[model samples]
Target: MTDLCPRFEGAMGIISKRWVGLILFELLDGTKRFSEMESDLPISGRLLSDRLKMLEKEGIVERHIYSEFPVRIEYSLSEKGTALEPVIQEIQNWANDWVTPENAQKD
Candidate 1:
């Protein structure tokens, strides 16, 4: 058998992290503020901040700042991140088929 491709392994290493995939899935809708994402997801503010920073560093997430009274900040997927939508969709489809509510609860 051929050895695993390093690039593919690297991609999976980032995507397979806890909350990472869900973050991507959520961002697929469009840009969102920190509080918006925090409320929409079940993750804590600190952890979500950490993950967003990591994704920003990896060029998967873009951070935007607006000049406003509250200094609004928003996050959106980069072109690279946008490319993940189809893959995420496929995973969603697979999960819908194989990962039932009961099956998911087992983990």
Candidate 2:
């Protein structure tokens, strides 16, 4: 066998987690407050927070703080994160074509 590419391996390790892809997809829509993301995804706040922190640490997500009355915080994709859009979209297309709920049920 040939040697594996570390760069590809690293990226897949980050994005292949259970909720990471959905988090990235949601962020692609635009910046979202923590509450908004929590409401949209079926994940728990703690897990979501952890995932966000991980993504933030990886430079894939940016956190913005607003010193408003409630001290609002929002998340959006960084340039590095935005670069994954086409990859996500392609995966979505492949899933749509081959991984419907009906097919999943059969599996």
Candidate 3:
């Protein structure tokens, strides 16, 4: 029998990391600066940077740098990342239907 689980496991390993799903979801709308992501997420800057680097390496995110007196950088989802919108939406729907502060507290 073909061992198909590794392929699925590999994909899950990346998305299952803390902050990765949320970061991807945040970028789904459009480009955003590092500061904007930081502001939107409760994650620390270092952790955010690490996750962004991982996402970029995986071709799920792209980083752009601007030429200016004060250099600026922006991050956006790549084509591969944009492809995850439906998956993200379904997860959001599931969360809305099941997960909640009340449910969480009971766990």
Error of 2 at 41 (Å): 0.2
Model 1, stretches more than 4 Å misplaced?
A: 105-107
Give lDDT for model 2: 0.95
TM-score of each: 0.94, 0.94, 0.90
**Cα deviation in Å at residue 55, candidate 2?**
0.4
Clashes of each: 0, 0, 0
Point out the higher-scoring one by TM-score: 1 or 2.
1
Q: State which candidate has the highest TM-score.
A: 1
Q: Write down the worst ten-residue block by lDDT for model 2.
A: 98-107
User: In candidate 3, what residue range of length 10 has the lowest lDDT sum?
Assistant: 98-107
RMSD of 2: 2.1
Between 1 and 3, whose TM-score is larger? 1
